[model samples]
Target: MATLEELRKQLDTIDDQIVHLYEERMRVCEAVGEYKVQSGKKVYDQTREKAKLADVASKVSGEFNKKGVQELYEQLMSMSRKLQYRQLVQAGALGRLPFIEVDSLEKETARVVFQGTEGAYGQAAMKHYFGENCNCFHVHTFRDAMEAIEDGAADYAVLPIENSSAGSVVEMYDLLEEFENYIVGETIIPITHTLSGLPGAKLTDLKKIYSKGIALMQASHFLDEHADWQKISVVNTAVAAKKVLEENDPTQAAVCSAYAAQVYGLEVLADHINNEKDNYTRFIIVTNQKIFLKKATKISICFELPHESGSLYRILSHFIYNDLNMSRIESRPMEGKSWEYRFFVDFEGNLANPAVKNAIRGLREEARNLKILGNY
Candidate 1:
C-alpha cells in the first residue's frame, strides 16, 4: 500500500524516535545503577520487572492487546535489567571505583586462545568472559589450550568443565591438574544441540551424524533413539555443523546449536536433540590473573588426599571448623597412586581473609597435593 521511499522515510523517523527513547532510558538506568550500588541491592530484579509489565499491560487496550503489551514490556524490562547489571558490574571494580587495578589487560593482551572452532561454546565463553572486542584463536584440544597458556603462546585460555546432562568433564579436570592456571571467573551456558545437514537433506536420508565430544555425550540418548546412524565426534559442535557444509554430503548431519545451523549454512533436521531439553554446560574462566568475586561468590581449589581412613573427613573438618560451606567437591584417582584419590573443591569466602588462609593451611597439612585453583 506504500511506496518504498515512503516506507524508508517512515522507518528512518521511527529509528530516530527509538534512539531518543533509548538515550532517555539509559539516563534513568544510570541513576538506577547508582542507587543500587549505594543500597547494596542486586541489579537484576525479576519481581520488579513482573510488576512493571503488569502495570504497563493494564494501561493498554483494544487492538494492541493486553498480552502483546505485556510481552513487549517484558522484553524491554529484560533489556533494562541487563543494562543495570552491566552498569553495576562495570561500576563496581572495572570502569570506575578502582578496588583492584586491572591495568595489565592491555599489557598482557598479546594473544587469546580457546578450545574448539569459531562457533563453539568455548569461544562464546571466552568472548563473554573477556569481552568481545578482540579476535580469539581456537585450539583443537583442551590440553592445547592449557599448553598455550603454559608455554606463554597465549595470555588466556578457555576450557569447558561440566555439563548439566552429562555431568563433569573428567578430561578437563585432569588437564587442570596437568597444567595450572588461575580461574578468573565462571560462566554457565544453556546447551541447544541441533541436528543439521546439507541443503535439501531430509531426515530419512541421514546415514551418519557428527557432534562434539560433549554434545555426543549429552545426546547419547539420540544415538540410542536412532541406532541406524553412525556417530562421528569432533572437537567443536559448530565445527561439526561446518564440516557438514564443507563435506556437502546429504547423507550426513551434525549436532550443534540451532544458532550454528544458520552460522554454518546448514539446515536444521532436528532442534534441541540433546538427551535432555534443558541441558546446560558450566565452564570456569581460567586466567593467569588473581581476580576476586563478589562477597557471595565462592572460590575453587584442587587437592588430593592419601588412602588413609578419614583422610577426606579430616580435610573437610577444617572447612566445618571455620564455618565455611563447601559448594562442590569432586574426586579423581591420582596418577601412580593405586588407592589414593585427588579432591577438587569449591568453597565460599575469599582466600585473602585470614581464616580462609588458615583453613587452606590446615587443608595443606591434611591434603597430599593441595593446589589453590583460584580465588574466585
Candidate 2:
C-alpha cells in the first residue's frame, strides 16, 4: 500500500477537480437561467429535477452512495433555482408584491376596532398603538373584529397575537388565516393581574373567579392557592370585573388588571397575582388594505407542505439560502385534514428586500397555498 501522505495527496487532487467541475456546472446553470428568463419559463421544473436525480443515482455505486448523490444533487439543484430566482429579480420579471408600501399608517382619521369591552387588554393595546384618543370601538368577538376590518367598517383592528408566559393566542391565528386583513403593526404591553371584587369584599369571601381563559392560566399559581374557588372563563378580564360589580355578590371575584378593576368600580383584594411577574402580551394591528409601512422590519407568512418526508426541510432551506433570519414559527392543524398542518412563520425582512422576494418565490413554487399574512 502507498504511504498515508501519498494517499492524502491523491484525494486532494480529486477534490480540486471536483470543485473545478462544480464551477463549470454552475456556469451552465446560469446560462440556462438566462435562457428561461428570456423564454418566460419558470425556474422550478419538478419533472426535470426528478429525472436528473434518477440519472445521477444510476451513475453512483452502492445504495448508500446512490442516496448520497441524490441528496447532493438536490441541494445543487436548489442552489441553481435560487440563482435563477435572483436573476429573475434582476431582470425585473419577478413582479411586484401585492402589498403596497406606505410611509405610515393613517392613525388620525382611521377608525380602529378591538375585541371585548372597555378596559380590556385589547383596548389597552389599541390605545398604545393608535393613540389614546383615536376613534375606536369594541366588538363582541375576535371574528367580529376581523370582520370589521374585512368589511371596511373599520380601517384597522387591534387583537392579541401572543403572550410571553402563556403562549400564542390560538383564536387570533385562526382569524388571521380566515380573513383578508393584514397585520400592519404590533405592540407589547406588560400584563399585571389582580384579584378584585365588590368594594367591601375580602379574599376570604371569594367563592368564584372570573377572567379570560388565558388570564386564568397566567394566574395559575395564585389560583392554585385558592383551590376551593371555582375558576370561570369569560370573554375578557375587564368584562369579568364588570360581571363581578354587576352581580354585587361578595363571593364572586375577578382576575383582571388593576386599571380594569378601577374602570369597573371594583376594589382590588390582591395585586400582581400572575404567575410570571414580568409577563407581557404582543398585540397586532391589522387592516383591510394590503399595505405595509416603509420602515417595517418583520414579515409573517403561512403555507402548507405536502405530507412527505423532508418537505418542510426543503421549504425552509429557501430562508437559509437567502440568508433570512426566521424569528418565530407556529403550526396549526389544517381544517378538514387529519394530521396535516399549516405552518406560520415570522421572519426578519421587509417586503422590498431582494432576499425576501427570492425566498418567497421559492416557497410559493414548492409549498401549497403560501400566503403573505403581513409585512410589519
Candidate 3:
C-alpha cells in the first residue's frame, strides 16, 4: 500500500484536477445552455449526451460498465445546466418571476389566457395570478388554450390540475401528457359554489341544474337530496350560469362560482353551496419557458413503463426509496394503444436537485416516455 503522504498528495492532485475540470466544463456548458435557452432549444439533449457517453467510454480506464460513467456524465451535464440556468437567470436572460416584467416577457402589454369564459374558475385564476390590471383572454376548451399557445395566439395558458374535493382530474392529467409546455406557476383558489337560478324561483320548484364536472361532484350531496332533479353536465360552470340566465329555465338551476352568476345575470339561490366548506382547486400556469420558482410547492411529471407486471411498482418505489413524497399519481391509457398506459405524477420537489435527477435517470432506463412537465 502507498504511504500516507503519497495517498494525501494523490488525493489533493485528484481534487484539484476535479475542480479545474469542473470549472472548465462549466465554462462551455454554461455558454451552450444560455444559447439553447435563448434559441428555445430544450434544456436536455439525449442524443448529444449519448454521443458524449460513447466518446467518454472509449477513453476511461476501468472495466466497469459504461452506464456508470454515463450516469456520472448525466449528473455533470445536469449540474452544468443548472449552473447555466442560474447564470442566465442572474443575467436576466430568463424572465424574472414573482412578478414578471411586462417588457422583458417580450410583450408590449401583459396578456393571460385560460380555458372558459369570464365567469369560469380559469378566469378567476387568471386574475389571481396575473392581477386585475393585466389583459386576459378566455378560451372555451382546455385544448384550445394549448392550441392558442402552440399557434402563437397567446403567451400563456392556465389550466386546473387537481381539486381538494375530487381526488384528481384524469382528463387534465392526460392532457398534461399530451401537451408540450412548461408549467410556469401554480395558483390555489378557494372554490365557493353558488346555487343560482331564475328570480323568485323556489328550491322546491327546481327540477334540473347545470354545473361543471368538479362543481357537480362537489354538490353531489345536494343533488342526492333532490333525487328527482335532472342534472346537466356542461363544459363550464359559467356556461351553465349564462344559460340559466339567458334561457330563464324556471325548472333549471346552476351551481357555480358567485362571480359567474354576477357575470351571467343569474340570481343566486344560495351562496357557498358546496358540500365541503374548504374546497380548493390547484391550477397550473403553462408557458413556453420556465417562469416561476420562488413560490413553487409541487412539480408534475410523466413516465411510461415497459409492459411488465412489476415495472410500475419498481418505478414508483424510487419515490419512496428516495424519500420524495408523491402528492398524486394516475394511470391514463396511452395514446395509440389498445391496452397501454402512461403514468402522470405530481411530486413534492424541484427537478433542480441531484437526487431528483438521479431518480429520473434511473427511471428513464425503464421508461419509454419520460418528461419533466415543469419544476413548479
- Best candidate according to lDDT: 2
Clashing residue pairs in candidate 1, if any? Answer: 194-256
Please provide, for model 2 over 20-82, each residue's C-alpha lDDT reduced to its tens digit, 9 standing for 90 to 100: 998999999999999988999989898999999999999989999999999999999988988
lDDT of 3 by residue, 22-46 (tens): 8898889878867865786655565
Candidate 1 structure quality by residue, lDDT tens digits, 1-376: 9999999999999999998998898788778878876787765464776688778878878656888887666556545544554454445412222123232344235477888786787777776777776557988888888888777778777788888788888887887777767766677888888888987999888898988776887788866787899998876788898889999999999988777788788888877777788878888766555545544257678887657654576568667766788988888887787977788888988755545654664565446667777765
User: How many residue pairs clash in each candidate at the backbone level?
Assistant: 1, 0, 0
Sorting all predicted structures by lDDT, with the top scorer first, yields: 2, 3, 1
Clash pairs for candidate 2: none
- What's the residue-level lDDT of 286 in candidate 1? 67
In order, the Cα lDDT scores of the candidates are 0.73, 0.92, 0.75
Q: TM-score-based ranking, best first?
A: 2, 1, 3
Instruction: Name the candidate, 1 or 2, with the larger TM-score value.
Output: 2
Better of 1 and 2 by lDDT: 2
Please give the TM-score that candidate 1 achieves against the real structure: 0.68
lDDT of 1 at 98: 16
Q: Estimate the overall C-alpha local distance difference test score of candidate 2.
A: 0.92
**Worst window of 10 by summed lDDT in candidate 1:** 93-102
Q: TM-score for each prediction?
A: 0.68, 0.97, 0.68
